[model samples]
Target: MAGATPLRVLIGKVGLDGHDRGVKLIARALRDAGIEVIYTGLHQTPEQIVASAIQEDVRAIGLSIHSAAHKTLFPRVLELLKAQGAEDIVVFGGGIIPDEDIPILHAQGVRRIFTPGTPMQEIVDFVKGLGQ
Candidate 1:
């Protein structure tokens, strides 16, 4: 498997959420771990996010939202991916999401949800597992 494509991930911030410090840290960590990261800066819409992911041909998407809009935004991204025939792209998210909403997000097709304070290594391991 020499010279295989390095796993690519798109890290995005959706909605009016101006909180970006955490997403930047996650993007840096992923890059440090040797994963190629395409970061679509703050204030992106779900359509923009999915379009960017497809254009980048990423293996996964990491969305961060602190706008209390997870219930709307996360599913919108998943739905858009499916509609674009890119459902194979793994979708995951993190933010101020509540524990009670984790299962809801999963049921809506978000593969994983990382709440605040989850270890950085945990996120890295999860993304690395996607490559295998």
Candidate 2:
């Protein structure tokens, strides 16, 4: 592991949503899978998320939103990332998002959206596959 580079991911909770249980689970799971996870805690703004992603130089961002703000917040994060020239950083998320909104989020540059009951290994494999 000395010379090999591990894939890094930023796990964030944006907007006013305070429920962090799921995000914490993901952070731990990703860490256990050998991915470096930078958890930004709760109530993070889109700007703050992008800034941290830029600073951490992560390969991806996994946001957990349960406040139904994904429609607005996710796109804002993507826009800010693009404006900051960090567009290459993959943006994905998981939460109580409705199925109808997934396509819009994808169009806004969110690479993936995992709903409740998604297997942990699937999330792990998704991020790992990004390296390939």
Candidate 3:
């Protein structure tokens, strides 16, 4: 993990969802944790997000999805990463998601899902623990 830069994170708001409160919070939390965080604002396409992640060379990609596009968006992001040979980058998601959808996401190669009320500390710990 040399030159890790304290675990960089790309926090993005994907799809047509204009709501970005959650992602903003995550970005601030990551920044406060001394990790480099890039906030991609709102209404980002999957391609834009992946491209940003690759450019930033972030260790993880955090998708803040409050819309009903996780099932579609999540897998698409994975596909984009695979296509670009960036499949090793850790994928994380936050915001509202059904309980039944968690396993499917993990099976689809998403490593972490942070639901509502997930503390900033937990998110920080989760990302840090991933490097272990």
Candidate 1 — which pairs collide? none
lDDT of each: 0.94, 0.93, 0.89
lDDT of 1: 0.94
TM-scores vs. true structure, each candidate:
0.97, 0.96, 0.95
Model 3 misplaced stretches (Cα beyond 4 Å) = none
Better of 1 and 3 by lDDT: 1
Best candidate according to TM-score: 1
Tens digit per residue, CA lDDT, model 2, 1-132: 243787889999999989999999999999999988999999999999999999998999999999999999999999999899889999999999999999989888899999999988899999888776
Whichever of 1 and 3 has more TM-score, that candidate is 1
Worst 10 residues of 1 by lDDT: 1-10
lDDT per residue, candidate 3, 1-132, as tens digits? 765456778899999988788888888988998888889988899999999999998888999888888999999999999999999899999878998999999999999898999999999888777666
Ranking by TM-score: 1, 2, 3
